[model samples]
Target: MDRMFRVLGFFTLAIGLMAFAGDLTEMALLFFLQTAFFVILGYMKFTERIYILLFWAYMFVTFTGFSYWTIFQMGLPL
Candidate 1:
């Protein structure tokens, strides 16, 4: 499970690097922060259920933020 977090961190780092190359600095920074977060979580000791819950909470927040940005900030057509 911890290994999974590290893997996710690396994947996020890769995405961040790609974003940076594409000139999406803000998105790259976001992914870089998330990569650091996942790496930190990977080193922490916690119950499996807690990790799962934390991940779900993370997903919810990320999705919600993305939705809010796309709808409100970006002003996409409905």
Candidate 2:
């Protein structure tokens, strides 16, 4: 589980690097923050169930925010 968090942190860091290369500083910064968060979580010792719950909560929040932004914040073509 801890390994998984570290892997996720690395993945997000990669994404942040890519975004930075693309000159999307805001997106890069967001991913950088996420990378930091996952890395810190990776170092912390927690129960298996707690890790699962935490991952699920993170997914829920991310998906909900993405859905809301796509639906209401973004300007899409009809």
Candidate 3:
């Protein structure tokens, strides 16, 4: 069971890297930040605090939402 979470964590990291690679400079920094977050979560799997990772996920989502909201208010396409 321990190994399962670790594998899942690595999977998340892989997905992050894949997405990070496709992003251009305009969004590259954000992708790198997100990839780093996933890397942290991957390590956390060994420490048994997966829930903390979920909390970060929530925060990221909230931040992204606020970003888009602000952009929309400014008459941006996305």
Residue 30 in model 3: shift from native, Å? 0.6
User: What digit string (tens of lDDT, one per residue) describes model 3 on residues 1-78?
Assistant: 345445555665566566668765445555555556555655654444655567567679979988997887667663
> Alpha-carbon error at 8 in model 3, in Å?
8.6
lDDT order of candidates, top first:
2, 1, 3
For each candidate in turn, the TM-score is 0.93, 0.95, 0.42
Top model number, lDDT: 2
Runs off by more than 4 Å, candidate 1: none
Q: Please give the lDDT score at residue 75 for candidate 2.
A: 58
Cα lDDT of model 2 by residue, 1-78, tens digit? 988999999999999999999999999999999999999999998988989999999999999999999988995779
Off by over 4 Å in 3: 1-23, 46-49, 52-56, 59-67, 70-78
Best by the TM-score measure: 2
CA lDDT of each prediction against the hidden true structure? 0.94, 0.96, 0.61
The ten-residue window of minimal lDDT in model 1 covers 69-78
Badly placed stretches (over 4 Å) of model 2 are none
